[model samples]
Target: MAEKEAVEATVTGNDQQVGFRAMVMKQAIAYNLAGSARNDANEIVHFTLQGDKHRIDSALATLQEGTKRSSDIKIATTSAAIDPGLNAFTIVDWTSSSRNITNTYNLVFELRADDTAISPTDAKAAWHQILEKTLNADDLKKLQPND
Candidate 1:
């Protein structure tokens, strides 16, 4: 049998809003690889895969392509020592971590004689409304600005 290998990768760019982690987990399971994936505060998706060398290479190719919702995805990989105890792949939720990031929405309103520029309060409200439609409650909570 071929020697097993481990790899750690960071995937960046348009990876957040999409179901990137779930997709990656599915692929990892399909390859019978063991490890975990999570989103970091910097909006990067970090993951580790360990298994047969050939399977790891194939998984890397799938990850680099990314899910349909992902765009401009770039993946960086490095060799890692395999963890003998790893048995299953999972999505690591870092919502409780201090590193959790709040998403800031900015809207620039142009002043016009016919239309008044939007007030800061109104702009903030509008931004939250957009988030409500696009993000889940948990994700919305993480986006709350620090006082």
Candidate 2:
């Protein structure tokens, strides 16, 4: 049997709010890949896939060819170490969790609109708080300036 391979990809450009994740999930499932796909706050679609080398390559190729709703899709891919425990492909709903930054931001806005104790300044503070909690070490590195 051929050794399985893994890949991590970030797809940007007209790839959000247009069922891009669903499309990618469908392709991954069809290719018998195991992994997950989700959209980040910046509208980038991040995905990880593990499967036969040929099938992974084919899926990536299909993804680069944007869906009907997507335009000018750009994808960046990198080889990833395969996770032996991954069982099936899935689409993660990051925003549904209260811990998610997007959800926190939405809550802040809702509180402000409801004429609650949350003032405009409080909303801004909430935004910063959520941003800090949400950004991981990798995200912080990306935001750092070159010395």
Candidate 3:
């Protein structure tokens, strides 16, 4: 059997909202690796790839190539402990309500209430309520510049 290894990589650049996570997942699956990818609020994508060391290196090279939608891709990798229980590659969504709808809609919704079980509709409604209460017409007028 081949030697197995794992690596955690942080990719910085124009990596968000560009199908970058999906591309990483596909490459990891193709390499028979197990781990995950996620995007942070700062627009960086992180990856955990575990399998054969050589295959991981290959995937890293391909990652350097970047997707058509991604540019200025830069990756820094570190050794990681192999996860014997991880059997597939997946995308880990950021756990924040402040994320834009494009990224938050399809994943789990997290809020100050600490309820991850809330449906998307409920989450949206909760956010709307918070905004309505916090930013009434008077508040908006106050925020406006005094002319």
For each candidate, the alpha-carbon lDDT, in order, equals 0.63, 0.62, 0.62
Model 1 per-residue lDDT tens digits across residues 24-60: 6555655666777877778688988877788778777
Candidate 2 clashing pairs, residues 3+ apart or interchain: none
Q: Which is the leading candidate under TM-score? A: 3
User: What is the TM-score of candidate 2?
Assistant: 0.62
Give per-residue CA lDDT, model 2, range 28-146, as digits (tens). Answer: 54556678887777768999888778877877887898878789899899999998877666566534221223432211111122222223344334534443565565443432221
Q: Count residue pairs with overlapping backbones in model 1.
A: 0
Q: Which structure is stronger by TM-score: 1 or 3? A: 3
After superposition, candidate 3 runs with Cα above 4 Å error: 94-147
| lDDT at position 129, candidate 1 | 51
- Candidate 2, which ten residues in sequence have the lowest lDDT sum? 104-113
Residue 53, candidate 1: C-alpha displacement in angstroms? 1.0
CA shift at 24, candidate 1, in angstroms? 0.9
